[model samples]
Target: MFQTSSALIRNVHSQVADRVGTSIVRGDIGVGETLPSEMQICQMMDVSRTVVREAIRTLTGKGLVESRPKSGTRVRPPQQWNQLDPDVLRWRLETSDMDSYLAKLFQLRCAVEPAAAALAAISAGQDDLTLIRTAYEGMAAAKVNEKFVAADIAFHQAIYFATRNEFFWPIAQMFDVTLRQSFTIAARGSHRARALVEHNAVLEAIATRNAEGAREATNVLLKNSADDLVRIRGREFASRPKA
Candidate 1:
């Protein structure tokens, strides 16, 4: 039936959007390149014009592309893209030509998380302490199941919450997820043990009620993260992505 309903064709749009997104994110479609026309998309994906329209809508929301009456669709510059959206962040990180974005992520982590650790040391009460300790235990126990990465992230998030500031929470989760996912894909677990020791230092500082110590410990931890980024990306950036 020639129905106007979109539900039946929604998956087509989603698949179309994802394929284009992968291209953009992976730099198959470099910045400022005008995307193929709707008819071209129809040929490429074997979908109706309606599906192309909806797929473009999805890309627009992601800050990945823009459309004009004359220009059709153009890929936006990285500066114009959304960084806070997790998918956008992941796409940018995965497709980035330079390590600049990765460096920035570590820089932000270094700037904010250490201060949060200091705050957590001063602000946490018994309940907060329990949460923090549990997070720590999760990390320690992670080696048994090789889930240390998630446990490590939980430990940091708990510490962020213990600071009595809600804002640091998202940053904590975002950086943690991005970094852990990258490590999982990139074979970069080389520095995991160093991070664990650094984490322990932060927890011990909190247990001792030493705010500055907590700050320093977290600073060292983030520094380790930054160092790993530098080392890994240096090798990855040494060669250009295959044409």
Candidate 2:
């Protein structure tokens, strides 16, 4: 009976997370809206308070909601969200936060990745360099152009691995997916040839152990990504259906 109850509790937690996350993403529970009280949620979902509490904790970790002593749980403002959390990132992508989110993502990259590349150039050992090179070569040899884009992503991932720092790796992994999507969209935009050139420039700098060059190359790569977003946004807004 204990085991059965535990399994039932787990199922309840998962269901609540899905429904709550969906509600938050769908704007049904807008930022700053108070979530249903524990008792209210328990009655609504027909679960015990323990299950509801656990689910709220899960959402809090993902930056979807927050709990205060007297105020109870409220949907967090965007500023308080764990933007680095993979689930949060996935939610943003699903909610089409791409335009606003991508800009900040580039801002974040500008602050981190170029410096990481420079560190890799100076400190990366044989395996580290090999990882970087392998990803670059994959980009170059990809039969499908889209696969080439994935290779480019792998190259940056290797650079993060070379940093040998735990704090940075997860953010690196999270953003890398969005970065790849952004790249594919941007690489198809106005400066395809130049974008490829920028990618090759980054690879050459890493291969040659030129730290300064690697940093600059990454900066150029991210700048182009931001530029491409501007173009993409313009086209999207132009085509958005009128209310």
Candidate 3:
């Protein structure tokens, strides 16, 4: 979704929002704690008060902070945050505990993607199939981690579009950063060849209008991905001290 966005340069307001948002999510600015006043933030960030105010407004829209007339803006509780916002998700993934985040992300994928695959089998047009096939070919050919993850995200995004379901599109949109990181973690396994096999199964099933087969193939792909995550992290977990 953010593929064309600049990585090196951003607007002053977005830069401030990201900085403050990351701090809030990281608990560097605790819930209910008031942020510095507009003047203070302007001085601290070396931006105008207008920019600071706009940044605060953006954060407020994301449910990360709330502002009152006299009280200023304060960080909100975890439950109050818009957890599904891609920016919020990226901040949490950047600053919070990763194992917990990936586990939850996998659970969400398990719940959504198989159903999407089944729907795609029933609804995809030729163009959709072509897109999916192209992405799958990219995955099969990728020799580096970066290429693999990019191709992998494109492959799943193709499936979401193929489903032709409005609701599934938003769910797929949510996967951008989370999905890439998960695939990167899982890419080291010996499962890449098997992943290609599973991908082909889903692709072929959708191409043939085999809904059940498509769903089952997606399940197999996800299960193996989960297995890969655990296998890669197993050694690190094993070495952790018992509580």
Candidate 4:
């Protein structure tokens, strides 16, 4: 009974946090705007003050809001947000303009991935190579989207780990959700075969310990990914209904 009640409280806490977080991200609660008072929130949400406080703490940890002694809690500017947070990433993707968001995301990937690939070529150990190769084989053998995406993430993540750079590891982790979404879009229609060849080019270059070749091959792979997204976006736009 105690455990069940505790679980119910946790659920309510999460629901409150998600509601407030989504509101802040969607600009319904604009930056610098103070949130409702704790007591007010408790009344509105039909939860205890403790739950509202916990929910506020949750949002604050995500860099969504800041509370002062007397002035209350206010939403922070977008620049202050923890963009890599899974909830923040999901909310932004759900609310923002897709074209602009994807373009900026790909730009970040283009800048970072090639350098990481080059470093991996220089630093990868035998085990690192084996892991990357295994991931590539999995990708090659995948017969469905779910399997392909899992292997694809593992393939890039292995390269990041192979770089042996502590800073690069978080980047590998950050790409999980975004890559899943991007790969799903890129794989639409008949692009998977070409994507596999592009991925193989990068893998081959890295395996040969050719730093410059790996960098160049990674660039080629990223460019093709961006192009695939563009083509798919265009097709989506063309197929939309006109009023």
lDDT of 4 by residue, 1-243 (tens): 001111124488887887788778878888999998998888778899999999999999999999999999999998998988877877777666676677777778888999999999999999999999999999899998888888999999999999999888877887776677777776675888888898888898999999999999999998888778878887543333322
TM-scores of all predicted structures:
0.72, 0.76, 0.89, 0.88
Model 1 poorest ten-residue lDDT run = 1-10
Candidate ranking (lDDT, best to worst): 3, 4, 2, 1
**Total clashing pairs in model 1:** 0
lDDT (Cα, tens digit) per residue for candidate 1, span 49-114: 999999999889989899999878999996787666666665665656445555555567777888
Per-candidate clashes come to: 0, 0, 0, 0
C-alpha root-mean-square deviation, candidate 3: 4.6
- Candidate 2 Cα misplacement greater than 4 A, ranges: 1-12, 25-27, 30-32, 42-51, 68-71, 190-193, 231-243
Index of the highest-lDDT prediction: 3
Instruction: Show pairs that collide, candidate 4.
Output: none
The superposed Cα distance between candidate 2 and the true structure at residue 229, in angstroms, equals 3.8
Which residue pairs clash in candidate 1? none
Model 3 TM-score, 2 decimals: 0.89
Using lDDT as the measure, name the better of candidate 3 and candidate 4: 3
- TM for candidate 1 is 0.72
Off by over 4 Å in 3: 1-8, 235-243
Superposed by TM-score, candidate 4 places the C-alpha of residue 81 at a distance from the truth, in angstroms, of 1.3
Highest TM-score scorer = 3
Candidate 3 clash pair list = none
